[model samples]
Target: MDSGIEIKVMNPRRGDNLVHPVGVGHATSASSAPLSSTSSPLPDERGLRQQQQQEQGLRQGQQRQGLIDFKPLKKWVPWIVPGFVLANIVVFVITMFINDCPKNSVSCVAGFLGRFSFQPLKENPLLGPSSSTLETMGALEVSKVVHRHQAWRLISCIWLHAGVFHILANMLSLVFIGIGLEQEFGFVRIGLVYLIAGFGGSLMSSLFIQTGISVGASGALFGLLGSMLSELITNWTIYANKLAALLTLILIIVINLAMGILPHVDNFAHIGGFLSGFLLGFVFLIRPQFGYVSEKHVPPGYIAASRKPKHKPYQYVLWVISLILLIVGYTVGLVLLLRGVNLNDHCSWCHYMSCIPTSLWSCKSQQAYCESIQYGNQLNLTCISNGKSNIYTLSGERPSQAQQLCSNLCG
Candidate 1:
């Protein structure tokens, strides 16, 4: 009875189906026992864990691919700087043709290379235009601008140059300095700064240089330098090595200004341009990074929640002051220019502002002068007339006698 009860229980546990005969019970037990032992949960769990890990790795790779890569981005090219260069070259070519620039002549080439490529300053009354061609082309002239109300010269003269070397030097400097500024600030802002600064330089030149025909892009270039300083100061946080950059810029400005102390350089224009650019820099070139937390780390919801600018209070104060000064400067400059304020009348000694004082660099009311010429032991006086290339010779034994004769004839 005990053996029968055990067999009945084992048969039900093995298989309850009618298809299995009584003899097949041992076979079923043998096959099912091995299957149950081999099929453990550990292997299945390991496979599942591997699949999950692969999926997680794939998701991580996708996220990395979605991130922005700033390395491959191309740098912005500045067209305005090149445009200014081309325009300057074109104008220079036209001036050369107008001046009847000689071809393949040593003295002519040398003159163009040096200072005498154009006519003498005193030959043109009131240190008028460098040449008749320049005057016709609207070169800046104190008498013409003040007396005739050709206020346009203030803008036009910035494009004019005295000689080949002069234009070459200025255009090179423009390309060097302007490209960087335009690249950083975009063309529109840079363009505005350049034009306004140039105008400011011209206005200042008119005020201080009361007796000369001034031309060239030096003032505009100086303005660019000034703007660079203001840019550095305003965006101090953004630049790497702030102190080094500031020191370098300051050094460049000082060196250039020192060059102005030399003869015939327009220092007033440099100062005006620099000052205008410095003031305008505070107004126009403020960077987005200034006085603000970087947007990359901020949450979208938090950024949207704060509608106010993240700028410091000092930044706002600077902006207001800069705008006010710029507006006032433009207003005052235009008013004074239109009113025909004769700076010469008000400041007779103002010519000294443009030139250094020395025995050789003395100011003259008339252009004519006497030059001593030596022919062996005998001395001769050459009387050079204003606006005329004709040389008159006064022959004499003594140098003093010859000088007296030249004074009588030339003066």
Candidate 2:
């Protein structure tokens, strides 16, 4: 038996569908057969198909694995921020009812102010409640807190506000800053920071403010600002434009603190809350991006080598420093508050300026006028001073009496 195969080649120039035999092969196997440029040289078609199928399956498997590994990031909603805002509004409403607040007028402002008044200068019987009414409520009065042991005022005062403008300013700040922080860190941490900061502010107020009833959430808002600063510092590496972010945050804090310099603003509360929040941020608000192992992952081993930290070494150092500072600060504040150390003894004007002496308003001048009139002495008078007319009359007296008295004195 003879085995042979014939090969054919076609010439394109002829343009005819014909093949001319080029060679005759003898005893040739499929494995040794010549392959065309377009044909693969594999001997077994099934094996080649199997290999191709395996490779295609591997690519498909890899794609499926990638899909399986992908996870959607968790979305956070700011329920706590809104909850706090609602609470503050509710408290303000309660205060309005208690103080018999008017709809809209200078009377309303005076009413709120009178309700929190601790001294004669602050009282206005025609406008609102007296200091007694505020004490009955939860106003943070130093005398009431220290002698009467009404320390709960420290917490309660944070929810109270003097008037519409006061609550509005505080709530606006809370919403703007608190919502973002609550979304990032969740409710528990933000709430904790807020409460602690508020308490810290209250403590400082009680320590220094000898007169007047202090209230409002300005201290807590300052805490949020401070926390933002610490957060920016700890997560500095992750931010694309850290310098810009830091400067903006610092500017906001500075502007807000500067406002405290204005008359009747509690600068101590602001300072204390900001300091507490700044320190607490390092302890509580640290993100996984700042280095520690993420809550999502578990370390295979307890050894240092097995636990990989993502944050730089300096971040950890800052964390430790912050914790220490917070501890020391709290300790000092507590000692001062508990020991009943009078801030006025050391710094007489620490709580308030001796005299702001504004051309528009002067508490000292008002106090002088009140003092000039003897207690229980009736007076009906009017005078022109500082390009404005002044008038005063006893509650039961008529305007005519004041005019007659003014004419008698001026004449």
Candidate 3:
């Protein structure tokens, strides 16, 4: 579902440029006598010196304001996005190797790849590993994380991809959105946004989607998109053509979120990541107000009559509100999750947000029941729903494992 698009950044113009003192020409013209009158007397040395000083201050203020308006902070070398890409690729390769689909099942797609072959299409249409393989590899499973104290899955799940298409879409979006933000804001801030937003996404997914394992970087990608929108708004005065940029970003976000409505797509993660990143944007992406002067720009022996505030009042309000919301949301979510509270029980209509049932396909969770009987060296599974039977070598597989296989067959 991921597609790349370029964002247009307009040139910044100083909105408050008129407030600065007028230039020397204006001052001289005002001081001169009218054309019909006799010529005015020459100004004194002290008066001339004062006028020159005033002009210098005016020029300095204009220069500093121009820098504030037009110049961006030092650009950061874009290694973080590339590094994340490499890390995700490495993890996917390792996952494929460990999956060894050929060894696990009687048949596998693309079997010529040996251990790297994908699970049967019926099992994993994403062209990746089986559910058992992903589960063992630290997919985000609510029961395991809550009952077994395997909390690391929250972080680990972000690096895991469900299949080839999943990783490709996510990584491409990451590169497109992430690199620019990193270059403008530096890696530390951008990295924090990615990780924290991902965690937030996982937390929400765990609460609502309790039946299956969830994996992918879609949440984090949405977080970056969320940050972009908030950054545009909070730093509203600095950018040119603000309305157009805002609308373009909104369109992109809306399209992406709409895709989440498809069956099997996790929209909770998208919403959670977006909300967290939006708040974080207000806290982290704030910019100085127009016409603000930095101390470094002040000339020796010159004191400004008055100074502009560094940030607008609205920015401060947003920062405080967002910070508080982030903290409370995380705390309340963690407490509820640990307590094993089922969110669906409280909100009857919430499930529809993740998926809407349609005539072409059903959104109900498939829970296939099957009876398994094991002989000395073989196992037989009979699906209760359709009375279909399949046999496989016992091969040390557990009861739960047999059930999963039967579920796939029934599906």
Candidate 4:
């Protein structure tokens, strides 16, 4: 054997090292042949499977998102504020329609918008401020004044403007502040802020000025303005050069409040509104939004609560209060009717500004009782006939026929 050279032999047992085909040794098998229609799904089948998987994921996403997601109530606060502002504008428009735009605003405009508002207290009942009333037949929802921190009025006094200018001014303020705040905070915050600020302003006004019947959403608007101001002050980063916007807003509000306070201005309401707005803006506006309001000012722990549906516990409270109000309102209505209050008793309420001038309603009581009647429809008719209650027929038939029909049903 040679020490320097060693002979190497192929291993016959190794699968890769097989002998030639003609040789007796096992022939090497070719590289593994391509799988015959078994390697993977067909392109079409794969596409379909992927599409199905994508669709399932999409459905799952949609399910989590929900239909008509009321979750973003906080995000919609600014929307609510602007909507409220719009409502006030609409009210002004309605007033314009009702008053027909008198040359001297003191007459027609004053009559409708300022019919019930806080004016300077005077010995004469006619001169002093009065409550805002909703004329229902002979019933009047007169404006009621509160004194000494009558906080409840904060909610109500917002609806009480002494004049068209006041309404216009306050509404304008709301428009400016509400739109911005709502867009940032969402509907829930805007709505709550408006309501709470309105309530707070009203309460503060009443607390300070008890005897006068002050009204108008101006106070709440002022509160909103104050909140905006506070927000600018606190978050100076965002509102750095927002001075023009702030000044314009302040001037508008100042002009309105000045008009109310300087000479005949209900300064109390303005001050109250301002303070309330300032306070609420701090309470509600402060506490920096989680990750910049985080899609709705959702608090750290209470985000879930904020995302709840519209008809939550608070809605239940609203419903309960609504029921209570409805019951009380209806009860009071029945009592007044029982007390023999006729349509003529409350002229301001019996008709629109006076009385419906149409001939279709034969009985004045029908008009008088219109407010008290439940589920009132256009066709439903209940009027007075010969000093007695009468129900009209849409068929325009004789009274005797209705009587027979009623008797047939009762019998």
Candidate 5:
């Protein structure tokens, strides 16, 4: 059921006809009973041999009917996903600690939380850290990544969450989707997919959305969904309710992607992570072909009539193609990003992918430009957008200080 399929087999015994939930390797027949000691002149070897052949034939038939779960059961405990959840929580706490909104701002939302109080709700509807705090903690900023050579932001941004609500939604999704995947595939594969997909998401977001800072694990979570879809397709023969499963997964993906159209959602990261994870899925989550017997599953002294290939020809073909596409896509995306290529300029309509403007809200990107002058331990910031100015007492200017104050002034 966790695999989104249930396999039922008809019991073949003559007397009591009953249908039962018999998965792969559990098929039974009346003739499968052990031979009596005095009954047969034939050697015990002959009986085992015949039994092996019958079982093999039955399994092969089951394979043709798609009644087998050829892939092995869960060999890994679910720990990596939980670890990811913990890591995100810890990082969010650190971000809030550094934000120190009560000290930094005139007032704070949820001020009762004291040092853990959130930035004003208008500034961050997600109830999270200040944009400057996020930027200092390695949020995704195109200017820093391209000009300052802070490529590490691509990976680090995924661990940073904007607010309590932002982390809450992402962590819940990670727990619901990630734990099951880790249990089925183990940590290494799932972990790589998570991290790489997140980087891919950041890379994509950096290329287009250069105006504001971005942070969240939405991309990584989307990558998990993409992988799930590809895993189902590549291992299509091993599953039941194939059409139903495919439709359900597709519907879920569509709905989630559609949600990205909302403002402030960062759909670019979601799309990028999904594409990356979809290709990576073909490379990492492939399964042995149906009817391909594992040597460990074979009975002793029974030789396989023919050794089937581990994967079907199409699987190998898909694997190669997906790998090539992934490499090429990453290389081109990185090169374009490092070169300061704004994908928005090249594709005017593409911005709609991230946000669609409606009568209720505008999708226009807000650019906060400011002039800053420091004198006698106080920095004065003037927002060019509205000619609004603010002065803050500071010993030294930090990189994101002017930008954060300007964002406030402009707002």
Candidate 6:
């Protein structure tokens, strides 16, 4: 046997001096395990350490993956925000291009959008009248005035604009705030914000508009601004106070607001839109934020009785009344809209400069003064000497030819 294969053996029965051959029974005496090797770890321990490192790497990779997942959320936001911006663009484009002909100019477009309404305003006919077919039918003259009130404008008025520039500015602001809110809160909520805000703005306009026609979506755009301001306020603590941004935004709003006070600018509509948007935003947005994060829950009676399944008596009545009012208003508006009031009809018979326009008369004029003209054997006569005249000459030579020209011209 080799020395490396040597082994030690002990027996209890043999005396101290007695010894046995350790290699007698076994062919190899040395063991495979080394003392140096025993001092160190075994294969299993090394494998476990490698596994722990691998797990740590995996955890780090998962953290990276989480961030990667979050980055893609922006790609999904276009559906909510961009969609509305596109829709507004489409509506305006359609409204503009569809009536580009000379007769259907901007004023004509305004009339079209107004659904041809004429009416006296409810409280102040001089302020702003309602604008809508619905509002037109609902128009009621003051008790003292027997004249039919101008048709109230609402829906179409919101879309109409004082000018192309007015439409452009309002549309631009709407895109900015609308897309922002839509991306953050999603389309459904953004749409609700837009509609409610717009209606609120319209209501404000309704209260203020006297004799001038009110138009444009700025009121609704203002509403969007209010809603966004609300979101910022509600999330200020969580979002790291965006004071600088808010201040800058406010400055921009103020400049535009000042512009509203300028000549031909509708300050009433601007103010109405702003206040309504602010109020509505407070009710729908700021209050909800507080409700969600409040340290202490609102008392049960404040919203509803804690134990009671039904709302409080006052709340129930208030809700009922609100619902009824909305229904009544909608019903009346619908009826008025279908009635198709025409503003031009009322103006057709109105006197202008005391000289009856050519439209009413079959002949030149009811009163007569003769003026003479001779061109290539044709003679023309009119009642007024220096008064304004419209003359047409056709290719002719003789009195018969001239008579034919006058007959045709007069005809």
Compared with the true structure, all predictions reach lDDT values of: 0.67, 0.65, 0.82, 0.45, 0.83, 0.45
TM-score of 2: 0.66
Model 4 TM-score, all chains together: 0.39
lDDT winner: 5
Q: Tens digits of per-residue lDDT for model 5 on 337-385?
A: 9999999899989999989999988887777788889888688888888
Q: In candidate 2, which residue ranges exceed 4 Å CA deviation?
A: 1-73, 101-132, 290-307, 310-312, 347-411
Model 5, CA-based lDDT: 0.83
So what's the TM-score on candidate 5? 0.78
Q: Which parts of model 4 have CA positions greater than 4 angstroms off? A: 1-78, 86-153, 237-239, 242-260, 287-411
lDDT digits (tens) for residues 1-411 of candidate 2: 233453232222355433332246453432444423443333344565687799999786666544433323345788988999999888766655564423211123434444332112223322233333455569888777777777788899898876556778889989999988888888999998999889888887777766777888988888888989998888775567889889998998888887776766787889889988998787777754522444344334322212446666777888899888877877887677666777768986675532243677554422111112323435533344322233343444232333333332443
The residue-by-residue lDDT of candidate 6 on 1-411, one tens digit each, is: 355433332222235322223333544322432222223444545675688799999786666544433333222263644555565555545444432322211123234435232122221122222222212223222210113423344444565543345556766777767766666566766666666556555544443333334556776777677666655554453344488868976887787676664443455456555655554444344312111222233333233112322223443443355446544644653343335433224555422211232454331222224455867534565535445334444343322333322222333
**Model 1 over residues 1-411: C-alpha lDDT tens digits?**
122111111212234431221223233333332223232334445666688799998786555433321112224679988998999888876775655422211123325433324333333222212355676677888788767889899999999887666887898899999998888778888898899899999998877676657888888899899999987887776678999899999999999987786676888888889989998888888765433444553434333223346555666677789889988987887677667665667776765655666777644444336666555644455567732222333333322334334434565
**Worst ten in a row by lDDT for model 4:** 132-141
- Global Cα RMSD, each model: 12.1, 9.6, 14.7, 21.0, 13.6, 17.3
Give the clashing residue pairs of candidate 3, or none: none
- Ordered from best to worst TM-score, the candidate numbers read 3, 5, 2, 1, 6, 4
In model 5, which runs have C-alpha deviations exceeding 4 angstroms?
1-72, 304-306, 369-406
**Candidate 3 local accuracy as lDDT?**
0.82
Which 10 successive residues of model 3 have the least lDDT summed? 1-10
Show where candidate 3 strays beyond 4 Å: 1-70, 297-306, 394-404
Q: Which regions of candidate 6 are displaced past 4 Å?
A: 1-76, 79-152, 282-411
- Give me the candidate number with maximum TM-score: 3
What is the Å distance of residue 184 in model 2 from its true position?
A: 0.7
Quote the positional error of residue 55 for candidate 4 in Å.
36
